[model samples]
Target: MKRGVVLLGAALLLGGMGQAQTGSAGSKVPLATGTGGAVATVDLDASRAAMRILEAGGNAVDAAVAAAATLGVTEPFSCGIGGGGFMVIYLAKENRVVTIDHRETAPASFTPTVFIENGQPIPFDQRVTSGLSAGVPGTVRGWQEALSRYGTLSLRRVLTPAIVTARYGFVVDQNFRNQVQENEARFRAFTSTASLYLPNGQPPAVGRRINNPDLARTYETIARQGAAGFYTGEIAQAIAATVNNPPVAEGTTLNVRRGNMTLADLANYEARLRPPVVSTYRGYTIYGMQPPSSGGLTIAEALNIMEGYDLSAMSEPEAYQKYLEASRLAFADRGAYMADPEYTDVPRNGLLSREFAAERRALIGSQAAPGSVPPGDPFKFQTDPSYPLRPAPAGFEGNDTTHLTVSDRDGNIVAYTFTIESIGGNGMVVPGHGFLLNNELTDFDPVAPHPNVPEAGKRPRSSMSPTIVFREGKPVMALGSPGGSTIITTVLQTLFDVIDRKRTLAEAFTVPRFSQRNAATTGVDLGGENTPLAQGLAGLGYRWAPTPEIGRLTAIQFNPDGTVTAAAEPRRAGGGSALVQSGR
Candidate 1:
């Protein structure tokens, strides 16, 4: 398979054009493209892996699965077979958008107070690193279901690159090295983790090659035997055993409550097919993942509220204020109402209703709200009276996930976001499996008697926003990001940049970002802090802080002339590539 060059500098090198200047930020992003197919991911290897499948005549879903599997091998800290996620796909033949909810589910023995002891909640670090935080993983089933349902390639064919990479190993880049250094102490605590990442009793240096034969075998088994290979065999036993009986480091006391996950839990897990949440903004239809993910509804609500304002006409400062206000209002409702739909009645219709957004829009004044805006009564607009209007509770989310977008010549598109929760999730490898388990259970509110509290067989709420945009019933864009709770705001701002400000795909991603998630102060990226927008916001009596990074957005845009453009986030050390056909 032939690959396009990924240029890194202020200028982007297109196929015909020598060097095209990007936005004001002077980004180093390589906006890859192809008339036949395009794939964008945070890792170059993963993007290339997907492109290989596309070159082999597989559709977008097949290429997406290949990319996702390759990412598990290369970027294991973010996501792997042990984690779960959401996928939003657009099928060209069917001319329809669909969503699959593979979010992790809590064990049947779980209770609202599972993370609580005596009358107080456990320390976050303790709970986050404990085996008790492991949820029933659904990523394997998700990959299998996607391939079986929509893909033309066999599982073995799609997973070859990942298996080979895991066996032969790849050089550790600066990003991979940095993550290992940051978590070196925690990695040292676990024998399995330490052995894989910490070579010679130290974190591997940049450019050092690392291999994981154990993970290679695991993937190879799944490829041959299908999802059952991981969910109902030795691999499943290893996952359950590690959770039920956690390993403790010498001279360190682990304050953890063990999980009661049996083999049955793994076998019973299933990825549900659901309808994608739909909304309209300036004649373009936006589709996103539904329940178990707060991203879709929250983004829709924010967009609805912002629709009342003319963002393109407003100055940067003025527009940012409205964006922040809308985000706060949407987050307020997200905290109170968004959860697993099967476990609780989420006011889905009312939350996304334009009428309800109008009511919330009235709350935004010339200045920001005094403090955290209270959640609105969306239940009043819906028929579900059982949906309680509860006060929002405080929770924590981490920016440890990866997102990918793929588009094929046939017009099929896939936008996927997956995570293992926090970095080096739970700090425990499933014995010899070589993949970290997710702490997704911690996404639930630790406090008892709350809407997002953990429940038996209940999926945890997520902020992974995999979105697709369509114009006149044809998909024009597919995008998503990974920033924990900030994912919604990042995606929303990008949408405004492209749709409202009329910026190119590169400009939309390169622009400075600001996020306010119902917090006392809004977080401004490094560039935003030095701009007049920051000063104007401060003068408006708003507190602002600097964030090193907000989110890593990977996007693919389809042009009216049948061309494809793909861009990856330049803020991080990631790249993208496209596959061109012989003709066209």
Candidate 2:
């Protein structure tokens, strides 16, 4: 009875949580402003799902889980329980920042030579569709542990929105349809996958409702039985069986490989709590995920190097040159050093040290450095090597990922980025689970002596950068994105825009992004390769390549007047959704 009263009062606190929906499919607002709390995601339904939790007395952790689960339903192609991810959380009461590493792990049977046959490596795409590409999923355990550790809500409560979203379904948009169309051939190869996504033997039309009753049931069982429901029960058996003996339809010409996943691998899966990577740039404190994921360390190192230059004092093009140079140097170090920490000794603190940044920044000349550069030794920068080596790992050449940001009135914040690794995730849905398994294992380099090569029970190195920024002991903003290795560059550029360039959140999102990652040619997105900026940079010996898109970033900022600003992309991935408590 007491709980009921609390619920009623909480529900009435904000009359707009449910009524905040401004429109249906294509009319979502990219930037939202309000007083209490806020949520931002790539999908409108997901933002509303998180907002509902906030309106019902849930904190940022609760709302984030709710948002993530909702994304699992709506942004199914990008992320799901069948994949893995990274989570960074700010516990307001404790005033501490922490991270969860739920990245997918290689099966115990995995070896460095797993992807190598004869003297050559198997084609990467062939491995992707095979069960061998799937890693032991970690999203479910990450969610369960997060709720248990810092949330006022239960797993069952947080999962309610996702179950509802999956059961009744949501509106299909152009992006969803396009993704299906893109993976048409892959879908046709698996009957279970084709049955769910291609109901009429074709992609569903845009604006139509697509329901996943199987996924809803999957969620319901997990809600009742906890992580064990998926990791150790009947579902676990089903997952292993599907991976070991793919349910490919007869007459499918594609030769799919088998995985060595076992029921014990599922039963033993665990999400770990890792210390957050902390760095300071021009007085603002930044917190991000540690290695096994290189997003945090790489961003910190680049920003630390950029801090040497007074960007605000330079011309736009000059600043960009320095930005590109800083990114290049940082990525050189990332490619050479980063990997799963439990597998190798990482030179973490040295990579992020002020001295190392100064040394690396010194390498940037008046002209762009040619091609890929060698990594600098950061060991001398460390006073005591207090940090685990946390250099950014080389990102896989894939970009299908999703991010969400949430902040509560009480100051708690969550920045989460997750993925199924590649579009449509190896193109094999669980036999009856209605979710695609991740192709995360393909993230391995497969080269001999490579730190990121596959190893028994090793987590794949990732570039999912979930970041939180603090000003004078209080969290002022949170952000993250999904674009494999480019994720680090994307977040760093946006952070530079917001903190250094003094651009509004919306304006920052509009800037044409240039991503340089220690490559001979930098990738440009939201702008063509023939832009004036590109032409001008060509004089400096910088080369350019046009990438379709870079990243889909979501962020929330705490304003001085107590209002929160939630921002998303307006033109990418059919735009995104940003919502606040009441807009009052």
Candidate 3:
């Protein structure tokens, strides 16, 4: 099996080809048709809902919140109220860039020994599932905060589409069906999950009308009462009681039972909004999520390193070789110094400085550095790993996520990425909430000597890089994706292809891309692990897995004339781009 491809007992394939529809069941009608409107989301319904809100006097911020809520309904497997995420909003009127960090945080009761076994590392399976793996969810709180400060629509209105879909039901698109089938065993293993995800004793087929009344009730409660409904109300109580009160269900795969998770964890959770980490690459200013998320710094570092070389003149093989080298350097620094700024002393400013970036890039030779080049000296970043190095090897843990971009005619833009942190997270579902809790804690290293090693109440490093681009201090594009650690590279590459290489939004996304995250997952394997693209990279001194599959990416760029251009990844279905014309 290759990286980024779906792997499970059910053998479900991603990137399936099918006819596009207008979001209505079996209708060939297109969903978006406008000039000034653009939405890039995991599902067409989700995107259309946001655009509709924008059409109805909602600001970009308002539309973004609604779009995010809608995604929780139509694309539940990837993201929902059970998860936490990040958002980048460019407030046009204020001329400000704000980043909301609602990324999941460890429970207050979390301990370093949580995943340790007699002071040794725990097995992958144990570290992956159960209540212990879940973090304090912040999706609801995050969305609410974004709306309260920047939006004009009431929570009730912004949440209506999601509520309607959950109550009335909607067709189970092929992508949804495939995701369910792929994780069937995990879903079946837990009684709570089995009851809801497998309502009819099996996952629904494509076009099957699937209604989640439980989720509807939960959404209704949240919409009416605000974020408090999901955090401290009946919904929260039910979740805490259900998982902790288990009687050893028949098909459970977890060895440990119950574990400590208090309702306090939910109630005390709060999402914070901070300024985005910004850097200039060529003429475009890039804005991405700040620390606690290494994505922004790593992207800036990689782009800066790549700038040292004249990649355009290099052959395909040479270009790939340099790309891998630069990525390795970035990953090294990320592993060594990146962490949640609230908990660690990360040098945020230094990481994005021109001097540091140029110095880091100078280490890359014309050829592939022998072995993995360690992070260069802090001052100069030498190309040789035989010299002083950074941290030990990074681990490979798969996570699933969704991305959305919303922009209104007023020039406000919001780019967002949300995730459950893994497919069928913890393989457990909140009893009646109809969503899976995230396995985000697994993102922390189980062993020591790694900067992101598990710690009490510490946020793990993440790659959910919701980003925006500015030209002459004005928002020009908004994009993000669900590619696990590959997210930073993919988003950065797409932005480069668009602004630097002069590719259209669709063309930039469709163009062959490469990624390098470490030895376990690198850009040299660009075609992905099991595909022809990987084979091609392998022939060029890159040791990619035989399988070639890369992560799915969705993006939208704004044309100064007010037209919106968008592109959706084929992995999650609904790849066609939609544009909403200005109402004026």
**Over 4 Å off, model 1:** 1-29, 253-257, 383-385, 573-584
- Model 2, range 309-364, lDDT digits (tens) per residue? 99988877788899999999998888877889999777887998888999998999
Question: TM-scores for all candidates?
Answer: 0.93, 0.95, 0.88
lDDT of 3 at 95: 88
Return the top candidate by lDDT. 2
TM-score for candidate 2, residues paired by index: 0.95
- Give lDDT: candidate 1, residue 447: 86
lDDT of 1 by residue, 222-322 (tens): 97799999999999999998888766556555564577898999999999999999999989999998879999999999999999999899887788789
Quote model 1's TM-score. Answer: 0.93
> Candidate 2: which stretches are off by over 4 Å?
1-26, 383-395
Arranged by lDDT, best first: 2, 1, 3
Model 2 scores what on Cα lDDT?
0.86
Candidate 3 lDDT tens digits, 177-268: 87789888777777878887787889987888877877877877887799988889788887666546642368566574455667897788
Q: Give Cα-based local distance difference scores for all models.
A: 0.83, 0.86, 0.70
The C-alpha RMSD of each candidate to the native structure, in angstroms, is 5.3, 3.4, 7.5
Tell me the TM-score of model 3.
0.88
Q: Rank the candidates by TM-score, best first.
A: 2, 1, 3
Model 2 error, position 142 (Å): 0.4
Q: How many backbone clashes does candidate 3 have?
A: 21
